[model samples]
Target chain A: MYKIAVDVMSGEKKAEELIKGALKALAEEKELELTLIGEYDIISQELAKTDFDSNRLKIEKADQIITMDESPVKALRKKKNSTVNVGAKLLRKKEVEAFISPGNTGSVMAAGLLKVGRVKGVLRPPIAIQFPAINGSTLILDNGANTNCSPENLEQFALMGQLYAEKVMKIDNPRIALLNIGEEKTKGNKLTKASYELLNNNPKIKNFIGNVEGRDIFSEKVDIIVTDGFVGNIVLKTTEGAASFFLELIKDSFKTNLLSKLAAFILKPYLKKSLDKIDYRQYGGAPLLGVKGLVVISHGSSDSTAIYNAIKAAKKSIEENMVELIKSEFAKNEELE
Target chain B: MYKIAVDVMSGEKKAEELIKGALKALAEEKELELTLIGEYDIISQELAKTDFDSNRLKIEKADQIITMDESPVKALRKKKNSTVNVGAKLLRKKEVEAFISPGNTGSVMAAGLLKVGRVKGVLRPPIAIQFPAINGSTLILDNGANTNCSPENLEQFALMGQLYAEKVMKIDNPRIALLNIGEEKTKGNKLTKASYELLNNNPKIKNFIGNVEGRDIFSEKVDIIVTDGFVGNIVLKTTEGAASFFLELIKDSFKTNLLSKLAAFILKPYLKKSLDKIDYRQYGGAPLLGVKGLVVISHGSSDSTAIYNAIKAAKKSIEENMVELIKSEFAKNEELE
Candidate 1:
């Protein structure tokens, strides 16, 4: 049975809702064990409201909660019993196979890096998110973890993203593409051009699809899209903003009159399915890859569904032994070098 | 009277459509003169169809056209009489106040940089596009021109963006914010953190707003948002993609049944206005800031409306003497240093 640590004190709203969601997930999956990291009295009271088995649910007391406004490094350093710190510490000690937090991203990333440390030869640890595309979801790495990166760091990101796609996403021989301004080898800045050369030369990256531009990101032309944190963050946030804006536009369109409302009902099912496809919260949290221990970070405003999905993602990553797989891939490359 | 050079061969659609649009623009305004650069025979034939005074329009012959696929550098070097090159050369010779193209971006930027050259003390030239926000449009600089940047380069971008907003957008004392992961001084990667420090300390920048994340990009928190090209490109493209996706979703929603189609008709006017508000094409093209001459680039798939607005934008920039303003701003900073 795999044990996972969940940061119950994290997220912007409804801590009890998150607990109830976790309980729902536990009921559906019999082999999973959950370690709820939060206030003991509050969690115990919430647990008493649910039908969750007392033996299966373990409560770890953490008096402090990391606020979204607090500095990540300061919060992590000072709040020893904070939910994120406690959860990460459990992962480090192997008390839990994985840790999941829907807290302040800075706090989660800091706790993961400072407590867990980097995997060997991993220059920069990237957070990978699965973006739902036309055919299926593509694994996009370094979504915002490492802002500045070296060519070697990008090379490692490609490998890590590739392995994650293969192991977790269950894609065989995932096509990896370097995100660039143009598809040409000579295109983009020095970094992307240099990365293109490295990714091309490296035999370790299976099906190196060369360079893909920003427009092709959602087209499902490649399985893994590797980019540095700066660009990755922009892309991620822009997508979110755009999605929200479009949803608002559609809602506005329907609310214009009675005819539009009737029309909305007719296409409601298909529209919901399409909306679900791009819903980031449905994918749960992004995984902080290339670290020694497993850690998943959800959005700050994530709800119960998002928190539950984050927990499931953590459990899946641990079960697949992603860290060991990444190590072995690096070891193979080192031997070849 | 402001004379602007218009590249009639740039867009993907019919050249006649662009010519007609130019004619319409010329009909509306009596103070502006346009030098239409394209194949003389085709432009002459199209011009004969319109009632626009030949005295107001000057047709210049270019033997060759720069195809979308041709190397920008190569085309600019080889095709001296090409529309883009001719227009830029006209601006250089003081025959026209500014140059506008709805054709190739690379050729426009390359021609502007290699031919027009940069403003003094400007290490790297940037492209600035005005995105329509809820309150008003915000000028987002370094959209994709220079990929790699130092903290100092970003500082220059901020200064230019702020100046553009103040002068063109007519916003008095525009708020400048660095695009980052968090609002704190210690937040973001090395580049962002460094940029934040520079922006925070720079006294020249009026209303130096703190770091704004991607979520706040569309908000009215700041009038000018500055970042490196790499991040800027991702945000720009993601916004474009999301807009396209959202439009498609609306289209699908409207076609679900007869009831929805009737509703779509009722909301058509309101929906069109909303979509038009966020439409980047309506903004014409991004301006190549810090260049010696005013250069505006429209979208590759730009239609007559976009081309017409591009010409108007070029005329406005010239009237305002934007290039001279930027040069003086940089000179003032140098004197201070």
Candidate 2:
């Protein structure tokens, strides 16, 4: 059985909804056990409303909660019983196989780095998120973690991202591409050029596609795209903005008139399914890879579905022993270097 | 009168179609002169079919043309008679007020920088583009040029972008914002934090509205969004992908059945209008700002409409004397510093 520690006092406005979703997911999936970290009274009250088995749900009391506006370092240092601190502590002690949170991103990242620590030889741990593409999803790493990164950090990101694609996403021999301005070897800034050279020289990479431009990101030409946090965050947010804008445009198109509204009803199911396929929330949260312990960080605006998926994602990481796999991979690469 | 040099050999296909569009635009607007730069024989042949005035439409012969596959810098040095080189040279010599091309971006930027040079105090020139937002279009700088930037570079980008909006876009007292991970001053990486401090203290910027996150990009929170080239490019491309994806979804929704097809017709005009509002091609091309001479770069696959708008944009920049304005602005700021 996979045991996961979930921060119940996370997200902006949907704390109760998340707990309810976690209970529902637990009820449906029998092989999962959840340790809900939050205020005892509030969580217990919400838990009472749900019809989940008492054995599947375990409560861990936390007196403090970190606000989104608070400094992550300060909050993590001061608030000993905060949800993020408690969840991370559990993962460190091996009490839970994995820890998941949809709270303050800075706090989660801080706690993960401070409490769980980094994998040996890994310069910096990066968060990898799945982006929907034509074939399936592409693994985009360092989506806002380690903003300023070296070429070596990007090379490490490629290795970890490739492993995640193969082991977790079940893609065999995933093609990795260095995100760049053009496909040419001589293209892009010094960092991208250096990273490209490293990736090309590294024989461990299955298929090293020279360079993938921004336009070809959604074309599914490669399975793994490795870049620094600054570029990665822009790509992530831009995708989110674009998705939201397009969804709004479609909704506006459907509401134009009665006839279009009727057409919308006929095609609503297929459209929803298509949107769902591309939705990042369906994939739960981005996993903070290269860390000693398993940690998954979701969006602050995450709903119940996102929380449930994050729980499932954490369980999958635990079951697959991703942390150990990553450590071993890094150890081997370091020795070779 | 606005005299603009138009490169006929810039796009992927249909040079004649683009010329025809430019002629049409010139016919509708009386105070414009177009110097159509291309192969003299081919341009004359195409012009023989149209009734455009020979005086307003001057054909210039260029022996060499830059191919899409060729290296931009290498081609610029070798192919001196290329359309891009010739047009940019004309602008540099004060023969034409501004030079516009719907062809190779790298060649245009390379030729523009090498031939025209940059405004004093400008470390790197940024290519700025306007995005169709809720209130109006917001100016985003360094769309794809100058990937790695320092805080000083971003500060210059903001000042230039602000001038573009106020002078050309005609927005008085434009609000400038630093694009970041969060709205707080201490939210972003070292580069952003330093830029935030610089922008906050600068008196040249009419309104420094603090930091705006990715979600607020389309909103009317600010007029100019300043970011590094890496992030800017990702945002630009992701928006393009999402727009294309959403439009495809709408088309699929319309093809669900015969009834849906009918509904599509009913809502077609309104949908088209909304799509047109967000159509980036309507804005012509992104200008390589901070260059000594006016240089505008369009996409390789730009259609006739895009070429025409590029010419129009070039004309406006010429009339506004953007290069001189940038020089004066930098000079004044240098004195203050």
Candidate 3:
């Protein structure tokens, strides 16, 4: 069984919603062993509501709660029993194969970096955000946090992203595309321009598809899309905002009048299917790539469905031995250099 | 009558389709005189196909054409008789109140800056692209070109975007917001962090709504949204790409099977109505704001509807005396500085 630690005190609902999701994950995957790190009473009470097997579940007692809005690094230092820090420690100690959180993202990353440590020379870790494509989805790196990034950081992002796609996403030779304003090699800002050259020259990164524009992110033709953390975050947020705004607009439009309401009623399932194709809940959370252990961070507002899928992602990442693959990839490249 | 120069030999179809759009514009607005700039024969031939009033129209002959793929600066220097350059000259010469091009964006900006010149002390000219919002629409600035920018550029963007929104978009004291990854003041990279401070400190900018995330761009609460050109362009292209991809996917989904086809047929009009809310054609082309003379650049794939709307926009900009307003706004700010 693959062991994964769940931070049950993170996100909006604290232990209640998170434990409910973890129980669902535990019930769904028999080959999964999960330790819910939070207040034992709150977690066990929430678990009492579900008819899940206790054999696959364990609740680690904790006295304090780290709210979502607390300062990340400070909270990590101060709150020893906080789910984010505790879970990171569990992963660091090899008590768990993976660490999953629906909490303050920066805190998790800080905990992962400070407690769990990096994979030796992993310069900067990137969050590989999954955006729905026409067929499957595109893995965009350096998505959340890491506001400023250099060309070398982007080069590492490409390397880490490509290996993750190859090993975890299980694609045969993923097509790595650099995000830019235009497809031409000379089309981006100073960072993208320099990174493009680095990406092309790196023999380890196969199928470097030069540069791709914003619209090409969901084109399904590309697999791993790489960009600086700043641009990547903007693109990620803008895409999310557009999707939500449109969904709300469509929902509002359907409520205008009786005929429109009837039409909306008929089109509900199909429209939902269409919207669900781009749904974040289905895709689960973003994987913080380049960490020593598997760390998947979900949106703070993630529900049971999101939590369930994140766990599934963790199981898959462990099964694929993604961390070992990344370590070897970097170690081999270091030798070549 | 407001005079506007139309680059007839620009974009995909050259004169034929462009003249068709111009003729439609002429038909819609009677207080407009249009100069079709291209080879005389081509313009007259396209005009002859329509029953346009010869008295309100004039054909200015130009020998060369700048295809979309040509290098922007080089094309501006070599092709003197090109429609983009000639049309810009007409505006510079005060022969036309405005210039509209549905061709290469860089070429138009090149001609506008090098030929027609920028407004006095106008630091960076931003392209204001309209996006549909919950209520009306939002004007987003620095949407195309200008790959690298500083906080000062973004500050200029907010000032210019606010003034343009006030005088032209006609929303009194438009709400100006800075685009960032997170809404917090300290949430962006160095550029945005500095820009946020500059925006808050600028006294000329009224209704400064602080930092807004990517998703908030479409919210009706915002009037004018500002960002560095690079991030703005990525957001713009990503939004466009998402719209196109979703539309295509919906179309493909509707045609999947007989049941879906029937459902699609039943919900066809409603779907189009919902999708049409986000359509770019209704709003017309983006105005290259902060230039001396009004210049509007449309998408290359713009049909007659888009062309018609762009011409309409040009007429509106001239009527608003947009250049004079921008000149005074800058003059006022210079005194404050």
Candidate 4:
């Protein structure tokens, strides 16, 4: 069984929802082992409420909880036994194959970098999230791990994102592209322009398809999109906001009158299914790439379904042995430059 | 009558849709006079095809056309008689109150800076676009005018954005907020963090809220959002992409089966009305803020409706004397700083 350490004490709901979600994942996936790192009393109470496989589920016992409001790096440094840090410890000890957190993004990133550590030859670890597009989900990396980055960092992200898409996403020969304001190699800010040259010339990114604009992102124009954390974070947030805004408009329009309400009732199933496809919850969370150990960061407001999906994603990553592949890729990187 | 110079040769359709849209606007608003700048033959022929007030619409002969693919500044400098340059010349000479362009963005920005000249105390002029939020439309400034910006530039954007939102958008005492990764005062990249401090401490921006996240932008969180042009542009494009993607999903779901198709037919009118509100064309183009004169920049793909709305937006800006207000605000900048 693949061992996974989950920071149940992270997120807004504390251990209550996360524990239940982990229990649900255990029930669904029998070949999984979960080390729920949180307050033992809370975990036991929650575990007692749900019937989970005692053989696969266990507790790591973390007392300290990292609040979202605290400074991420500072909190992680001070609260060594915080659920995120504890989970990282388990992963570092080789007791768990993957570590998952739904707490403050900065804290999770700090834990991944400071506690879990970076992969060999990795400049900066990036968060690669699946963006739901017209054809299928397109992966975007450097999704808020580092606000500022070098062109080399972006080039590295391109290679990492492509590999993740190929291995975890299971896309055959993923097309990699740089995110920019315009499609031209000469287009965009200094960072993108410089990164464009590196990404264009680099043999590591085989299917580099030049620069792509924001509109093309959701059109299945490319399989892997590489950008700095700054742009990537904005894109992710904007997508969520816009989707929520549009969905709200559709909901309001249908509920405005009795006739439209009845029509909405008839189309409810179709609309729900369609909306669910774009929901970030369905895709779980983004994985922090270029980390030594597998790390999945779920959305702060992830419910049971999101948590369950996140666990499944962890299992997939472990099965693929993505960390080992990443190590192998970086081992030969010294000769490329 | 307020005289306006319309770049009739500005988009892909040449003078066909632009002339018709200009004619329609002239017919609707009798107090407007349009100096259509393009090839004399094309303008007169397209003009003759429609019934318009001869007194309201006139043509300025221009032999050059700047293709979208051409280098913006290079084309603008070489093609002196291009529609954008000719219109800028008219505005500079006080022959027209406003210059509207749907051509290359960089070329228009260059023309506005070099040809028309900047407002005396303005550091950098930004492009402000209306983002349709749940409560109402929120104004976002610095939408791709300048990629690299200082904190002072964002401060100026806040005041200019507030003025535009107040006068043109008719929102009194608009709440101006700095766009950042998080709502906290210190949570962002160097540019955003520095800009946040400036925006928070400045007195010119009366109703200043602290930093707001990307998700809060489309909600009724604030009246005006200010950021560097690069982030602003990405947010604008991402919002457009996500909305289009979600709307397409909704449309596809309704047509997936015969039962849902019937339901869609029943709810067609409501859906169309709801979608139109989020449509950027309905609100018109963004104003190139901090310019010496009124400059409305529309999307490259702006059709008849978009052109008509842009004309309306230009007229509104002129009536509000937004340029004069921006000049006055910057005059007192030293004392405020």
Candidate 5:
């Protein structure tokens, strides 16, 4: 059985909704087993409303909940029984193959680093998120984990991102590209400039496409784009903001008059269907890669459906043996060096 | 009369369209005079098609044209008589109050730095562009000029961006904000964490907001957002790309079925009107701030209308004495230090 730990508390949604998602994920994947960490009474109360297989599911009590605004370090230090901390401990103790959380991103990352630890030869763990593209999805690494990074960190991110894309994402010979201000190899700040040379020279990285601009994130040109967390986070949030801004503008236009409002009503279903490709929920959670164990960080405001998808993402990571692959790959590279 | 030099060559569009824009700017602002630098024959031929004031418009013959793909440094050395070079020379010689170009952005910035030079006490010149906001607009500095920046560079961008927002954008006591991943004062990479203290501690800055995320770029929160050129450029281009991607999706949605097509046809006019606020053409060109002379960098793909609005933007800067204000503000700060 592929055992996973789910942090049922700390997200914006109620624990009941998150439990419903966990149950749904259990129902879909027969070989999957879950240990839901939260207030035992609350989990029991929520699970009482659903029909779940008792053999595949278990409950672990954790009273404290880490909030969105709390400092990651402080929360880690004080909230020993929090859902995120319990989930991390589960992964560290080998009680679960993977851990999933929709709580604070910083907290989850910290817990993953401190409790679960890094893979044997890994330098730093990076959050790799997939952006919906014209064709499928483009994977971008170091989404917000490490704000400042060295060239070696970026090269490692490129390798790990490529492995995730090839194995879990099922892209063949994924084209790896550097996220840069300009497409030219010579056109970047100090970090990207030095990173370009490293990425270009690495024989282990196949199809090392030189550089791509922010606009190319959604384009079908590249499979994986790597950058420091600072730029990646800004690009990710900016794209989200810009998409919402345009959608709002469209809605306002539909309210201009009676005729336009009627037209909007008639076209609502089609618009939603077409726009689903840009929706974040469909892509599931961002995986905190390079850690010793699989850790998936979902959006804080994720609903049951988003949570369900995130669980599926963790299942895929576990099935693919992503952490083992990363460990062995880095071991091979170190031997070669 | 405020004399301005126009680089009639090097943009993606034909020179005739650019000359037409220059002529329109001259017609609208009677006190505005333009020196159009391009091929003499083409300028004369295009001028014959329109009825323009000869006294307000003059042609400076330059046979060479800088292609978009040409290296900026090599182009500057080889194509000495290119339109951008001639325009920069006019600003340097005090023959024009301002210079405008729709050519290669790198070429324009290089010429501005090598030719007109920096303002006294200015460390580096930054490109400041205004993003279309829900209320008015938000000014973001270091758009693409200096990719790598120190904390002091961002502080200066704040001051320069504040001055432009007040003088050119016509806002009263513009609020300056640092673009960061999080809103907290301590939440950022090395550059932003250090820059925040500097911006907050500076007494000359009238209103310094703490921090804004990428999602806040278009929100009606603050006036000026300061960031390193690398992050700023990515945000700018990512915003542009996301907007276009969504618009394309909307268009595709309308073509899904017969009824949806009818609705789209009915809503076209209103959609265009409401979406005009997000249009890049309305914003004109980005100003290269902190330079001793005014240098406005228009988009490479700008058409006649965009070019016309850019000239009007230059006219406003001249009327407000924007360069002089920045000079005096920095000079005063130097004395205080």
Candidate 6:
């Protein structure tokens, strides 16, 4: 069974919501087992409400919860029995193959580093998230993990991102691109311009497309886009803001008069289907790549459906032996160097 | 009369399209006069198709045109008599109070710098564009003007952007914000972290809201968002990409079924009305702030409506003495320092 630990008390949703979702995943994936990390009473109470297979499920006791607003390092230092810390401990003790959290993003990363640790030869564990693209989805990495990144870090992200796309997303010889201001080799700021040369020179990267602008991020041209966490984070948030703003504007328009209201009512179901294609929950969660153990971070506001999908994602990661492949690949590169 | 020089020979659209738009602006604004810079024959031939007041329009001979793809510095050297150069010269010679172009962006900035020059204390002339925000619009600066920016440069941009928002946009005590990954003061990359301190310490800035994340950019929280050209450029293009991508997805859904298609036909006009709020043409063009003369840079894919709006923007910049206000603001700041 693929064992994954879940941080049930740290996200925006309550313990019951997360446990409910974990139970759903446990039911769907017969080969999957989960260790719910939270207050034992809360987990047990929530578990009683749902019909779940007890053989594949276990609950770990935790007294504290790391809040979304708390500082990661400070919270981890103080809240020793926090659900996030407990989940990380479970991974560290080899009790679980992977750990998933929808808690404080920083706390999750900090705990992953302090507890499960980094992959051998990895500089930074960049967050890799799938952005909804015109051609299925494009994987964008370093999504707010490392705000300031070296050219080497970006190249590393590209390397790891390419592997994830090929292994997990099931794309063959994925096209990797450096996200920049322009498509030209010399177009970006200091980091991207230098990183372009690194990606170009690296033989390990089989299909390194030179550069792609922000507009090309969602296009069918490239499979994986590599950027620093700062740029990548901004891109993610800006997209969210723009998409919702447009939808809100459209909704407001539908309320203008009777004719438009009728049209909106008729078109609601159809529009929802189209909009669902861009939904984030379908993609599950962002994988914190370059870590020694598999760590996926879900959005803080993730619903039950999102959490359920995240557990499925963890199962796939474990099944594919993602961490081992990445570890071995980095080691091989080091030997070559 | 407000004299504005127009570069009618460049951009994606034909010279006739630009001339027709300029003529429309001329007809609407009685006090506005234009000096069209282009190939004399092409300008005259295009002008023949449109009925324009002869007294308000004058043609300047330019034997060359600057294509969008040409390098700014190289093209300026080779094509000295290019419409862009001629228009810049017109502004430099004080024959026109403003210059508007939809040609190569770099060439426009180069021409402005080489001919019209910068305001004495200005470090760089940042491109200030009005982004469609939840509450009307938010002015964003350094939209791909300076690729690598120092903290001081960002501070100057915020200052200039604030001035432009107040003087040109007529926003009262505009709320200025530094765009970063997070909302906290310490939650930013090196440049923004330092810029936050600078903006906070500067007593001259009336209302400096610390930092805003990318998601909050389009919201009604702040009036002006200050970012380096690299990030700003990405934000602008990403917004364009996401907006169009969503619209395209919605359009595709409309064709999925005959019933949906009928509903789409009914909703089309209402949706168009709401979407029109986001049309780039309505905001005229991005003003190259901190320059000695007013230089408005329109989108390359501009239509006649866009051109007409750009001319109106140029007229307003002239009427408001935007250049002088910025010049004096910088001069005062420099003196205080």
**Candidate 5: tens digits of C-alpha lDDT, residues B6-68:** 888878999988888888888899999999888999889989987988988889887887788
Candidate 6 docking class: high
List DockQ for all candidates.
Answer: 0.46, 0.49, 0.58, 0.73, 0.84, 0.86
Ten contiguous residues with the weakest lDDT in model 5 chain A: A239-248
lDDT of 4 by residue, B177-279 (tens): 8887777887788888888878878766799988887888889889999888878888888888888888888888898899999999999999888878798
Q: What does candidate 3's lDDT look like per residue over B1-337, in tens digits?
A: 9999888777776568778888998988999999988899877777776697888999988878888888888998998889898999899999998888887888988888888888887877888888888777888889865777888888888887886777677888789998887777888888889889988998877788988888787787798888877888899989988777777766665665666677666666666687687989888888888888998888887877788888987888888888898898888878877
iRMS (Å) per candidate: 2.5, 2.3, 2.1, 1.1, 0.8, 0.8
How many clashing residue pairs appear in each of the predictions shown? 1, 0, 0, 0, 0, 0
Fnat for every candidate = 0.42, 0.37, 0.54, 0.69, 0.79, 0.85
* Alpha carbon deviation, residue A173, candidate 1 (Å): 1.9
lDDT of 2 by residue, B1-337 (tens): 7778888876786779778768977887688888889888888889898797677878878867888888989999999899998898888887877788877788888988999888887889999999877768889998878878999899899999988988888899999999987788887788899999999988877788998877667777789999988778777877776667666655775676786677667767767776676887788889999988888888777777888788777777777888889999998877977
Please say which candidate is ahead in lDDT: 1 or 4.
4
Q: Write the per-residue lDDT of candidate 6 for residues B1-337, one digit (tens) a residue.
A: 9999888878899888888889999999999989988888888988887687999899999888888888888999998899888989888889999999999998998888878899989998899989998878999988998999988898899888887788778899999999998888999899999999999998878899899988887899999999999999999999999988998889988888888899889988988899898999999999898888998899998889999999998888888988998889888978987
What C-alpha RMSD does candidate 6 show over the true interface residues after superposing them? 0.8
RMSD of each: 2.3, 2.1, 1.9, 2.1, 1.3, 1.2
Candidate 3 positional error at B59, Å = 1.0
- Give candidate 1's iRMS in Å, 1 decimal: 2.5
Candidate 5 — which pairs collide?
none
Candidate 6 per-residue lDDT, tens place, A1-337, comes to 9999888888888888888788899988999889988888888988887788899999889889888889899999999999888888888888999999999999998888888898888898899999998879999998999999999998899889988999899999999999988887979899988999999999989999899988887899999999999999999999999988998899988998999899888888988899987899888889999887888899998878889999998898898999999999899978977
Off by over 4 Å in 6: none
TM-score ranking, best first: 6, 5, 3, 4, 2, 1
lDDT of 6 at B256: 80
Which window of ten consecutive residues has the lowest lDDT sum in model 2 chain B? Answer: B241-250
TM-score of 5: 0.98
Best by lDDT: 5
Candidate 4 chain A: worst-modelled 10 consecutive residues by lDDT? A328-337
TM-score of every candidate relative to the true structure: 0.94, 0.95, 0.96, 0.95, 0.98, 0.98
